[model samples]
Target: MLRRTLAAVAAAALAFVAPVQAQAPAAAPVEIQFWHGLPQPLGGLLEKIVSDFNASQARYKVVPTFRGSYAETMVGAVAAFRSSSAPHIVQMFEVGTGTMMAAGRAIRPVHELLASTGVNIDFADYLPPVRGYYQAADGRQMSMPFNSSTAVMFYNKDMFQRAGLDPNAPPKTWAEVEAAARKLKEAGIACPMTTSWPAWIQVEQTLAIHNQPLATQANGFRGMNAEMRLGGALMVRHMQNLVEWQRQGLFRYGGRDSAADGLFPSGECAMAFASSGLRARVMREARFQWGTAMLPYYNDVAGAPRNSIIGGASFWVMNKGPNAGETGGRSAAEWRGVAEFFRYIASPEVDAKWHQDTGYVPVRRASYELTRRAGYYAANPGADVAIESLLRGGAATDNSRGIRLGGYVEIRTIIQEEMEKAFQAGQSAQQAMQAADTRANAVLRNFERQNARAAQ
Candidate 1:
């Protein structure tokens, strides 16, 4: 009888233990590393998106690392790739598109990556300009468009009123811009006008807006033999005007890149030609009323004010593997996780939220429609200026589409250097234009040579 009792107790213990063994803890979610180049509030907003995504899903946790400026981030990503420790995604500026496209075995086209995981993204949902900028020659998307922006005029309405200019009317032409600058200067405004990304605003976007060519072969889209066309009559005239304005204190040369972005918000400069993305910063930091308008043009050039091209960065997926441009040894599940994360962000609700928060043009048309329906544009006047500027002209011509040339980052540096020399009276505007053309062409030729070597 005692033996039977002991056997019954053993059977109960075994049943309890079996249930406990069957209920092992779930596996931890996969972690994805994303590197980007955005400062301050923008970076904080991006993290919020990632955090919300993590909370919604149990499969992946995305960790974003701010990798300094665009140039620094690109350099770091390249080094990471060489060391076989690259992050899954990197935010590369639009100018680096050519370089990223040429990086064999280093990048995995997002379309292909998603399709491999049974997820097909409809590129049609994205805006044409935003879509076209990142597409391959074969119509395949090379990367995911994020934070796309264009140049615009940001002016302080209070200053405009004080300067005796029409506060409701912003400058519409280069002549008008100059005239307004003079008024602002006369009104005791020390820094009447300044520009961020001088090369982009004064050169690339200027060429596109005026329907001028920056390079031959349809702005380098046709082939790699495209040469610089920087010394045109219009460019020379515009550069000369900038130099004259600087001399008269109508315009101030506020350093390079985005270093001059603060001048407007800090109330130091009354007017600024800067990225539309500056809307977010200006809104948060500006103490006075501000307004945004389309970039000014010369009006004499045929098809002038065509459209401005995108200036912000895109998300590039890196493939760091030993194979020849194959997968990065990531498991199928992991790729699915990445695809899922992308799908979540690309949804209309999430995308619209990002656009509204960051001052970037919505990549997806659906997102724009959603934001409009939600009364975002009505509540915030001038928020749609970027979109309107991009769609000002009918269809984007070759001149207004975008620039795709290797070593463009270096070329921009060269242009800025030459322009600085002109502003300081070290060289004439005409001479600066000629020097930039010559030096930029050399950089292109060197890029071609490097590409040839890599292919062989």
Candidate 2:
């Protein structure tokens, strides 16, 4: 009789403990997939930032995955979509804007996603040059600008002084750049100047700076029927100048993509035209005093000093399932998690930290203002050059607006290939550009045909 009484008391105590346990909250985390293109050294930094975000709150967790280069990462994202495993966020290069915008059903526009949660992001709050490229004709941002950057002139201060040029007074015009390069060459420097992304910096950016057309139909902003305007008289003159520079030994080709990122920082070249993102790499690699300046432009050309174009990448939200919440019209648990994460990233504190840590321009106006108030620019001279150049015109025009041509990435390849023959002295600038135009037109026409079908 005593044993039965003891068992009943134990059962009552167990039942009481179970109710308390059931009343407590669950600590389970919502997972969101994030894929990017930064390799090794920089990838570690990305991982750290993502980790910090994940640890900041209990609402969501972001899984950071290094996909590959921008082009490769984009391909990977598309493949994932096909396989029904699309990432919550994918980093796409600026040139891919047209292609992504064309992929109608694949992505949920950022503005739309955020609006579902009753939050509206002001387009005016973004830097004009950075936002213009990603905006639709109806004036809405298609994706979130993560790492927007512009082309800038990076130079070795030591080499500048050694070449008898004032390190503080960087060349402001293409003529001045040529003069400085001549002096550096005369100083017995083997490689006076080199450039990364020759097509991007020398051709595309130069066109924009001169307020020239890259293609018809507003550089493919209007419609898919745009054709190449890169073979115009202005382009011909620019190419002729480049070919002359090559022949004069004043300019050296430093390969493509980020291959020549090392050339300037290593002190092998006095100057380079590369993306503003190279600032971080130069700081880590350069043994000499280095500085940045606005990209040199042609003084003779009308409207020659317009704002430069933006490079770098942004986070594009994939549809068909990024969040796990039940799907329909209302915001699901997954979308709320995604929006929360975006707010974390777009916050001024986070944006400023990212700008300081990397060389990329902060996309948000508030972030830029915050960074300026922190005296980051005053302390670090030349850092604000990109910002100043980007804000030059107050607003972007058809000529100064960024390139959005379909097949832009492929056209870039054709440009580089044809320009190679000119650099090697095997063909004239006119001939090289003509051939490139023919090849580029083919690509553009093909893109038109493909997208026309998609639109239909």
Candidate 3:
């Protein structure tokens, strides 16, 4: 009787535990690290996308790490490559193209990487302006365009009304912009205007919009031997104009970086020049009525207001198995996982959502059409201004296609530093451009020497 009672109790306990054992989750999938520069809400959006992708498949999990700013992230990735501890992917700003392209052993081009994994993604589906920027000279894509943006003008509608300007009619040309700025100043607006990425917005992009070149050698697309032409007549004149505006209180010098992005939303500046990607920030932070318009161009300059160049970042797959351990390459599973994640990103639905969430120019044609059909543009006036501006400019030229130069981040810094001297009255606009070009050329020359030797 004792034996029977003991056996029965043990059997009952076993039954109770069996169900729990059966319900235990399996080991998690392999994780692929993705290093990026997005912070806060943008980071949250990326994480959600990763989570969604992970849930849709059981093969891989993406681990996203927030590195510092765009420049910092690129530097860190390069360092990681040297140590053989780089992530599976890195988000590189548009300016990093030349460096990334020259990093011959540091990355596997997206087209080649996906092909290696037997995933034949259609490269033609990508929006031309966005894709063309990352493509190689031979027509192969070098990286994936993730979040491409262009310069746009943002103005406060209420402030326009207060300043007695047409709230419905933002300035279409730089001449009109100057007149409007004067009115805003007369209205007692604290800061009439400011700009983000002064060098990019005021120099390279501005040059391109006017159908002018910033550099020789096809803006560094052909080879490493390139030189800045920004010291030319047009650029000097533009800088002189800015100097005058500053004197008249029509333009406020917004720092070296994107600090001006905050001025417009804070209701301090009546107008600001910022990235189209800034719409997400403005939507969240601004409490007053605001509107976006085409980037103001000089009406007197022929071919003015050409398609603006991209400003945001792209996805670059870090070289797999840089150390290569015992294996000759990364595990096939890892390659497969990377390809799958990329496909998820390329999906039209995903791209459309990205366009709607952030005012970035859609990188896919299908994505743009989908977003339009879904009534996103109908509900959000002026949201598609970036797209329209991109289409307005017929085709990209050697000057306008995009800049591909080594040490571009440093070059931008040089331009900014020299421009600051002009603001302080230490130099004239002509002197600033001359100094900037000199400094920028030195950086480009150093890059040319390094890469030239490496090639040999």
Candidate 4:
């Protein structure tokens, strides 16, 4: 009886093993981790996207992890790379392009990945300015653009009316902005004007709007041998104007980047310069009527009204760990999944929805057309200002594509410090600007040397 029972069990095992050995094995689900920096509402939105993708496909699972602010997230990604446990995808800010590109063998260029996977992604479909910033000199896209934003003017309609200014008309030039600020201040407004990201608004945008080069080598688009040229007449003059306005009480200097966005939304400031990304927050928090306008420009500059630069981030794919093998030389299945995800995010419908919800400019021209057809701009008023500003010109110059400096965060801090000393400590604008140029150039040189050694 015992022998018969053992024989029955052995036969059952043999039957199962024979079938398993003869048949093809089921493919294991590929898991890809996405590390991002968006918090709160944005973070939740990203999670929803990931959830939808997971539900739509069984072959791959995308897991998203919030890794804090942009700087913290970047540092964390670097540490993870060291441990060979980095996420497959990372959301890096625009400033980190130089650093990411410099990290050899760490990242796989987006265009190369798509091509290897046989995905037909047309880079031409992307807006010029958006593509220009993310592309290499040879016109290869290094990463995928996700959240993009340009600087714009946000004004209080109620305040404009109170000052007897036309709510429908906003200042188009620096001179007009000054005139409006003076009127608003005289009308009993405590803070007639303020701005967020002074380094970006006052310096970076200043260069782009004035059609002036911020650095010698087209704002470091060429290489790290670039030097700061922001001490030019245009930049100095603009800084001086701000200093004078601060003294006249027409302009209130707010704490560093994005901290003063709340002041404008709260009705404390009549007008403010901020990123287009602030649209959702402003719409939600602002009690009074507000309007958006193109950034003010210097009338004297030849191409005074050039397009502004972008401030948001992009998704960089890191080649690390065991998962890298899954991408292979040309995994059609995996490539299709990635291309589909990009298409979903960049599709006209999705772009329009994102724009309506977050106030970010739609990346595709078709998305803008769809939004216009839906009368979103007409219903929301100032909603069209950002798009108009972005499309004011045909194509972006090297300068208009924006700065790509290494150690850009430190450079921006140096710029902020010098400007603060000039505006708050009563230092001369020329002196402050010259000092900033020197300091920034030192940082550039240091980064160049460090990267050069890394290359060797």
Residues 1-456 of candidate 4: C-alpha lDDT, one tens digit per residue: 787567556655654554344333475555677899999888888788788778876666677899999999999998887776777789999889878877656677888777765666666877777778888766789888877888899999999999999998988898999999999988899999999999998899888877899998888888779999978999899999899999999898897888788888898999999998888888889999888899999787797788788888888877664223433322344444555566567667777877787777877788888999999988988787777777666688878887878888898899999988998766799999999999999998888888886644
lDDT per residue for candidate 1 within 27-63, as digits (tens), equals: 5677788999998888898888889999997767788
Q: Write the per-residue lDDT of candidate 2 for residues 125-171, one digit (tens) a residue.
A: 88888888888766788888878889999998898998999999999
Clash count, one per candidate? 0, 0, 0, 0
Q: Between prediction 3 and prediction 4, which has the larger lDDT?
A: 3
Worst 10 residues of 1 by lDDT: 321-330
Leading candidate by lDDT? 1
What TM-score against the true fold does each predicted structure earn? 0.90, 0.90, 0.90, 0.90
The sequence of per-residue lDDT tens digits that candidate 3 reaches over residues 1-456 is 787567556655654554354345674566788999988778788778888998997758888899988888988998887877788889999999998988776788888887777887677877666887898877788998888898889999999999999999999988999999999999999898999999888997788788788899888888889888888888999999999899878999999778678999999999999988888888889989999998888889877768777888999988643453322134555656778899998899988897887677888888989999999889999899988776667777777878889999999999999989999889999999999999999999999888875543
CA RMSD of all predictions = 9.4, 8.9, 10.1, 7.7
C-alpha lDDT values of all predictions: 0.86, 0.82, 0.84, 0.81
CA deviation > 4 Å runs, candidate 1? 1-25, 322-325, 453-456
What candidate 3 gets wrong by more than 4 Å, as runs, is 1-28, 321-328
Minimum summed lDDT over a 10-residue window in model 4 is located at: 322-331
